[model samples]
Target chain A: MKNRLRLLAYPYILWMALFVVAPIVIVVIYAFGSAGGGFTFDNFSRMGTYLPVFIRSFKLAFEATVFCILLGYPLAYILSKESSRSQGILVLLVLLPMWMNFLLRTYAWMSLLENTGLINKLLTLIGLSPVKMINTPGAIILGMVYNYLPFMVLPIYSVISKLDYSLIEAAQDLGASSAGVFRRVIFPLSLPGVLSGITMVFVPSVSTFVISQLLGGGKYMLLGDLIELEFLGSAYNPYLGSAVALVMMIVVIIMLLIMNRFGEGEEQAVMI
Target chain B: MRDKKSRVPGRIFLALIYIFLYAPIIVLLIFSFNSTNSRTVWSGFSLRWYEKLFNDDMVINALYTTISVSILAAIIATVFGTFAAIGIFNLRRRWQSPVLTLNNIPLMNADIVTGVSLCLLFVASGTILGFGLGFITLLLAHISFNVPYVILSVMPKLKQLDNNLVDAAQDLGCTWLQAFFKVVVPEIKPGIVNGALIAFTMSIDDFIISYFTAGSGTQTLSMVIFSMTRKRVTPEINAVSSLMFVFVLILLIIINIRSSVQDKKLRAKPA
Candidate 1:
């Protein structure tokens, strides 16, 4: 019976090898070899030309991650302070939008941010000048923040709520002001959650093609858009696409490593 | 007085954040009822788009594909992932971490990279065999991506499980399989359900991977919605979005209520 139970894993192992392991192996091979089947360094050489794109992707993703932290930290803190019943409902509210189709949510932003859309119309009604919100990097950043804010909030909220309240009371009794208590005690204690939130927001934002495509109006291309274009666009080159994907995989792995370093000796509090 | 004053700002901040989070969904829902196609102008309330949405062949086909793919992928991933979790749990302690890390690779990798890599695999396989990209490849990709989430959710529950219960059941003249089904399965049922739910949502919400692997002929709702963005999307798309939102909201509310009731029952009973 034990042997049979062990045998239950064989099919799953086979499936993982074929679908998960083999696909990534193929990407590495394609990244190294050319379409003509000869080994070449041309793919890596060609990636140098797109260095600016990589920089821009990382920059925008970093900006978006910062915004998510700023906005989400306060909300999470407030939620964690609430009664348990209210906290459950508020957390559900945060998660509700996430369950909606992300493309649809991003598309909704298109209507709200367009020049003649809802925000601009409201601005005109109130005698304010309409700002060009769509088709810009700022708009893409907004979309990223909107879509990923819950991911940022949930982890921090989980960590903050689990914090020992006695520590805060102890600090206050020691004549530490509330601000100092938060900065010195709360923030440091929540570093694991904050670091995980940054990784969660940054990794997806850097690699997102759809959010940029919908909000950036194709004028601003991130690394994800570049990789998609190579595979599915008119510039269909699998080798080049694989090389770009390999680079992205490396960057994401590095982010995961950073997250793991901070999350060390914890119970992996990060969840999507 | 100071505590009350501090509470007001916290309340206001939460209200504003809720507004920010919900504004787009509210606009989408409202637009779904507009008579005219213009998103900003609410000329009058009408269900014309909702009516049209039912007859739109492309939208219906994409919905069919999305539902079938997600359901099939979720079920398969749950079964395999549950057994795989059990197998990993029973392994010698040293081997578990490496195998679990292998499981985490799909969960950790970016969606675009996974999509591109899988596309490369399928395209290569197509050249070797005479098959082309279609529903099968899309289903396979969805299942592959979903299994890791299932494993993650189930592994935690497996760890929390008391293995001695299963041993007790087996010693009571039950076979190993019977002990598993009667004792272990019941204990880990919540995790299995949670894993399946995650799998279903991930499969439905996927776009980048589905876009690459689905090819031109077969499209999920996400792929269709993506293509619709290239043109001036009709309000029918908004109608579909609103319906999907309502469906998911209802499903979530039911789950929340059921779980809360269970929580109450658990609390009411003595530990």
Candidate 2:
């Protein structure tokens, strides 16, 4: 039986090994090699060239994450507080657009933010100056929020929905004010969801290409765009792109590990 | 707290969010019928864009390509993923979590990084072997990206299965494969269906991976939309998007309805 099970496990394990494990291993190996020569530390040595790109990507990702948290938390709280029937409707509303294509949705943002689009027209009608919302950092941030807000809300909603209401009442009955009740009772309980949501939003937004390409325009040089330009553009340098990709993987792995540890700790705390 | 004033802001926020999400869709639908090439102005509604969309041979080719790729990828990924999930269930406890995590890593990795890395790998392979990129590259990329999602979706159902049925089937002299086919599959068939649905959607909706992997003639629907929007916003693109949205909405509703009906029948079965 055990031998049969082991045989059954072969195809799955091999599939993952070839696709997930092999591609990343290839990246790490290329990251250590010189572009056109023997093995060297040249890739790592030139890290200074890419440090600003990392910083900019990290900053934009951080800002987008913060926006997701702020917008997603209240929406989650409201959904959690509602009756399950209405909550179902709310969840559907959030997920419907999510099921559509990501590129399509980003294109939708382009239409909405265009100078002659609806928002600008509305602004003109109200006698306000037309603001160039498209192709700005603000547009990138808005696009991030629009794409990822559902991801943030769902996890937090799962956490908040399962929260014990009696805990809030207990705090209130002990003369805790509204803010105190929230801080002491609600926030701590929902930290797992918050952490997971932030990780989800941050990791993807950090390396998203289509959004930055369509909405951010070529004006901005995100890490994703840089990697694309090197790997796929006129510069056809796979070695450099591989190095950048490896660095991104390492950073994201670190973040995910941190989030996992935090989540585990929070779970233990909740159990206690 | 349940009173009117407390609910007011929440109601407004919900409304605003709905508007934010759906307004683009509404505009896309409206503009699809506008006679003007520029989508913003009101030049009277007509079916001209729809007519043009049908006549465009490139659009038709892209639609065919996108549908074929998604369907093929969905089937292969679902089969591989389901087998993998079952195999993982039978694995030693110590190795299971890590293996699962390894599989999930693909799901979490950024699309751009994955696309670039895969493109490089294919380029290297093609250079070494003297082959050109085409449908095979596209399929492999789709399968790699989709298998993880399928595993994640179906694993939970596999975990919930009762072990006794398989044991009983084995005791009745059924072969292992027979037992698995007769006992295990039917129990978790819903998971397989759900996993396949998700894979289909993800494969169809993917932009970055397809962009990287597709050849000049193998453009998908999303690639067409991307190129069109870059050139200029046209009512034809809007017509396509609105149609795509409605198609997805209908699919979602049908899936939900089918599952609910199945649930009802399951509940009526003998305990």
- Give me the candidate number with maximum TM-score: 1
**Residue-by-residue lDDT tens digits, candidate 2, A1-272:** 65566566678888778777777777777777766767877776776788988888888889999989998999898888788878887888888998777877888788779888778999999999888988898888888888988889999999999988899889899999988988777988898899889878987899877788788886777888878877767867677778887888798889788878978897688668
Clashing pairs in 2: none
Measured by lDDT, the strongest candidate is 1
Report, to 2 decimal places, the DockQ of model 2. 0.67
| Candidate 1: tens digits of C-alpha lDDT, residues B1-271 | 1467779989999999999989999999999999999888899999999999888899899999999999999999999899988887776677678777788778767888888888888988998998889999999999998988888898889889887888899899898779989998989999999999999999989888899999889999988888888886877778888999999989898988899899899899996
Worst 10 residues of 2 chain B by lDDT: B115-124
Model 2 over residues B47-142: C-alpha lDDT tens digits? 988899999998999999889999999999999988888788788889888998898777778887777667767766788998666788888999
RMSD of each: 3.0, 2.2
- C-alpha lDDT (0 to 100) for residue B105 of candidate 1: 76
TM-score of chain B of each: 0.96, 0.95
Best by DockQ: 1
